[model samples]
Target: METLVFRFEQGQRRIPTAAQLVGVVSSGNLEVLVSRAELQAACEIEVNTAAIGFAPIWQAVMDDFQARWQLADVRIAINDMGATPAVVSLRLDQAIEACLESAP
Candidate 1:
């Protein structure tokens, strides 16, 4: 699938997360928290990182995430430890996939 530009607007119905999935943040790891929620109008993403001047990069990642999934009321909490953009993206995908796989 092609990556589309990310926009902040009301999304589709919230996708239910079957369980909490965590991706470790190490040399080749990224910690991610994916969960379902009853958001008011948009999805919420909280990204905590040690890297400085990386807000734009994270925004780009979130853009891609919003494009890839219908996270209307989903909550994604991420903890990063100097992981590259590619790694961050990978972890996001992994977290979403895990949620879908575990869904009833």
Candidate 2:
């Protein structure tokens, strides 16, 4: 297993009050946990993945996610079991949607 962490500083909004978990961690799949945190105007993402030596690819995905969401004071944890990048993006989007739905 490998762990990768990424931080982005362009966040424009803080996450909602409620935390959200989405997807199932299984073969060729992943799970995402999203929540608000004291990130000091940054969005942090931690990925624990079974596929090793893919940091560059994961970094790209993380960069894209940060660009699209611009989340602030948010921490996203992802557990990946050899999932594709597309699946990873999808799960992140789903988690964000579910989390934002609980917004006031």
Candidate 3:
């Protein structure tokens, strides 16, 4: 098992109104938990994976996600079990979408 943490400073500080979670940790799958945070124009992501020796790939995937979203003041936790990068991005997007939909 390997764990990685990343923090990014996004100039846009629009936080979601609520927290959300999506996906499940299983063979070739992962779970994502996202929530509001007091990060002050930043986003923090934590990834725990059963697949080792893929830090570079994970970083690339995360970098792409951050670029695409540009979200701020959010904390995301991903429990990964050998999921592909595509699935990882999908789950992350879904979690954020769910969170936004929860807004009143």
| lDDT of candidate 1 over 33-82, digit per residue (tens) | 87776676577888777776777787888988788876776777777778
What TM-score does structure 1 among the candidates reach? 0.82
Rank ordering of all candidates by lDDT, starting from the highest: 2, 3, 1
The numbered model that scores best in TM-score is 2
TM-score of every candidate: 0.82, 0.94, 0.92
Evaluated at residue 13, the lDDT of candidate 3 is 47
Worst 10 residues of 1 by lDDT: 1-10
Model 2 bad stretches (over 4 Å): none
The stretch of ten residues in a row with the least summed lDDT in candidate 3 is 10-19
lDDT of each: 0.73, 0.89, 0.85
Error of 1 at 69 (Å): 0.9
In angstroms, give how far residue 31 of model 2 lies from its true place: 0.3
